[model samples]
Target: MSNISAAIPPVRWGILATGKIAALFAADLALVEDAELAAVGSRSIESARRFADTHSSGARAYGSYAELAADPDVDVVYVATPHGRHVEDVMTCFEAGKAVLCEKALTLNADDGSTLIEEARHRGVFFAEAMWMRCNPNIRKIQDMVAAGSCGTVGQVRAELGFVAKPDIARLWDPELGASSLLDVGIYPLTFTNLILGEPTHIVAAGIKSDRGIDVSGGATLTYTSGAVASIAWTQMAWSDNRAAVSGDGGRIEIAPRFHETTGFSHARNWELDEFAEPVLGRGYAHEIIEVNECLRAGRTESALLPLDGTLEIMRQIDEIRLQIG
Candidate 1:
């Protein structure tokens, strides 16, 4: 690592949109040194002030997103808006010449993601898709193990995430808001597949659509050029095993339930089983936060691990999957 890769000095953070994810991010940010919750913006001033007061003391609160974007004190901004508004929100950050860490599925489609990348590059601003899983130490270790041939030729992989979400939730049922479980939850498993199998050569998708013309539950099969296969599934209407497993002729590995978050994993080789789990550090978001801080400190515009190319390819896969299902 270069000397410039040190953690950022006194990084000031501004949050756009005050919601559950925003609150969680603020709480996690507090656990990292040299990082400050400088401001938060919401559609309502009162709401912004409430979030600031509860999550960050003495932090500026703006009633509108544009004001927060224009805050000169903020070194970087985290765009936490709904999926439908990500493009506009991220563009606002870029317009204000602020580095951005936007929430994932970075944009509604692959083309939009490319647009964000183009603008960020044109302006020479730091940008990253908040694919937190890619930044986790445990996930990196797993990737290393797979590359070392621990799983032996890796013939197949499978991942599932699901919960019994009620239909009353607006974002869960509203088609206009990008309410597909495939986009909201399935991205995790799909990303996992991409990490393990690279990009798939062919994809087959089918799912259950809601009355609002949204996919509430879905499953997909991905076949790679190496002849490896991955099966992925997500649902907002039921409970599932929520485990991910990879198998090969030599051995197998199983990530514990709720694999999206860095928990633990089980590995078996030659009928011998072992378990591995990394120590916790601030609900697992701290790692990604640290990665961003290091990138900014090094004056880098994009992360090598979470590059835009991978994000765009995943999006293309998403588009293809949705097309097949529809």
Candidate 2:
């Protein structure tokens, strides 16, 4: 716990894009005290200036990622580009001696993730895949309960996350965008399942690919060594129930819409609700920033809430599911 409590340097963050998710994260980061939006860089200077004006406190803005990464004031960079662009974006930051917090699916596959991790280690800089959901305080509480046998031996878990996504888009449906239910939406359930039940020994999956040859919907079942099973489903072509449930011998845990959002959660047993109603501030994304700040202050590279190894293992499972389905 000493390392956990050690003083972390205030991290100067360089944001790498002005996309929707980037805006969301920037807004959330603004709510945290120790994080600084020191700079923003985009392919277009116009976009960079616009984002900086709107989202930050007049931080340095650059027209290119190279310039942003080269900024001496920037201690870390948030790689908020699209899935396919993740590799190039993060690599640029690492090459510039900047630590990085890359978005989910890390890099389209396990191999790319390994490369990035190794590169970060070799450079002696912090590197983390921004699987922010795992850092939510409520999710961590739920994990604690499950691990403490509060739910007894796990029997089965079911979770799903999906939203209606247009078919004609360049991002969600375009095969070149690395678009797929398996990568975009499926990663949520896969991450949640791994957080609760650990890695599965085997996985069986079926995918529904759109006319554009991208997976728009999918379902997967994982069988674990402890005989616990997790079944997950994801879709982008249409909206789903958008709920998550973890069932065990003693009780069940249910997370509501946008389970990753940390709005609230419930626990029940024997047909009676035992616990309910815990709320958090500011969209719930800020906690990950807080965790990152705490780690940086403590001089740690990886977060306890979202460990590097756990991220790689979850990515490997995603790869396996893709291989099994297609």
Q: Give the clashing pairs for model 2.
A: 7-297, 8-296, 8-297, 8-298
The positional error of residue 128 in candidate 2, measured at the CA in angstroms, is 0.4
lDDT of each prediction vs. the true structure?
0.88, 0.84
Worst 10 residues of 1 by lDDT: 1-10
The best candidate in terms of TM-score:
1
* Best-performing candidate as measured by lDDT: 1
lDDT tens readout by residue for model 2, 216-317: 888999999999999999989678888888888898898988776656788887778865555564777677787777777677877778688888888888
> Residue 111 deviation, candidate 2, in Å?
0.5
For model 2, the superposed segments whose C-alpha errors exceed 4 Å read 1-9
